[model samples]
Target: MDTIEWQDFERVELRVGTIISAEPNVKARKPAYVLQVDLGEFGVKTSSAQITAHYSAESLVGKQVLCVCNFAAKSIAGVRSEVLVTGVYDDENRVVLASFEHPLPNGSRLA
Candidate 1:
């Protein structure tokens, strides 16, 4: 494993955001969703996530998720992905979203 200074870790903008909307990403070769996240002061951002194995568009709405907010925007499939919705792969190799049980304000930095 590699170690990093606290400052280096702090530089990563890990924030919580609510899923405002989600829909299938038709252009993606693999099944995926195009999500619109409400990031409070940071505004709404878009991301393409391959979480179909454990999530559905209807189930994701109103869910609060962790996001890597500082990464540069990139085109994923046909969507212009902005923030990176954080998650871990399960034993089945399916993505399980990093989520919060209690509601947190959108754009709240992870500390």
Candidate 2:
């Protein structure tokens, strides 16, 4: 694995954001959802997450999750994904999101 200094890692804008809304991305070839996350001062950002195996549109709302906000917006599955919703793959290869059990300020940086 590539090693980096703490400052280098800190440059990545990993923040906490709450899922404001989610919907099925029908245009996607594989199953996916288009999510809108409220990032406090950063405002609402969008992402396309392939987490259908463990999540639903209804369940995602109001959930807080880690996000990488510095990446440029890109088109994914017909949606303009603005931020990366960080997650880890499970044994089944399904994505399980990195989430917080306690509420944090939106856009709170992960130190």
Candidate 3:
């Protein structure tokens, strides 16, 4: 794996956000959800996430998740994805979200 300097890691805007809303991204070719996350000072940002294999829209609301917040927005399946909701691939190649164990203030940086 490539090694990154501490500064490089710090440049990444890893922040906490709560899922205010989640719904099916019907425009997506593969199954996906359109999420609206409240990031405190950052306000609400949208993300198009392919996590339906393990999560449901009802199960995702109010969930606290880590996000890569600074990447430029990309258009995905008709939605403008703002932040990237972080997750890892499971053994079956389905995305399992990175979540906090306790409630955190929205927009808190990951240190």
Candidate 4:
């Protein structure tokens, strides 16, 4: 991987957000969900996550997950994805969310 300076890393706005709501994104070719995340000061943002393999809509609500907030919005599966919900892949190639065990204020920045 290419090494980046501290400033470069700082440019990526990695923050914690709470999932306010989630639902299936029917327009996606692959199974996915449209999520509404509360980013506190950043307000609520939307994301399209391909996490249906490991999580359901009911399981995602109220979950606190990390996200990249500065990314430009893009159209995904007929929805506007405003932020990138971060996750790591499991051995089964399913996405496991990067979440917190305890509650945090919405839009908490990751240092």
Q: How well does model 1 score by local distance difference test?
A: 0.97
lDDT of 2 by residue, 1-111 (tens): 999998899889999999999999999999999999999999999999998999989999999999999998999978999999999999999999999989999999998
Question: Ten-residue segment with the worst summed lDDT in candidate 2?
Answer: 2-11
Query: Candidate 4: which stretches are off by over 4 Å?
Result: none
lDDT of 4 by residue, 1-111 (tens): 899999998899999999999999999999999999999999999999999988889999999999999999999979999999999999999999999989999989998
lDDT at 13, model 3: 100
Q: What TM-score does each of the candidates earn?
A: 0.99, 0.97, 0.99, 0.97
Point out where model 1 deviates above 4 Å. none
lDDT of 2: 0.96
Worst 10 residues of 1 by lDDT: 48-57
Clashes of each: 0, 0, 0, 0
lDDT score, candidate 4, position 50: 98
Q: What's the TM for model 1? A: 0.99
- Clashing residue pairs in candidate 1 are none
Clashes of 3: 0
Candidate RMSDs in order: 0.5, 0.7, 0.4, 0.7
lDDT for model 3 comes to 0.98
Report the C-alpha displacement of residue 86, candidate 1, in angstroms.
Answer: 0.4
> What is the lDDT of every predicted structure here?
0.97, 0.96, 0.98, 0.96
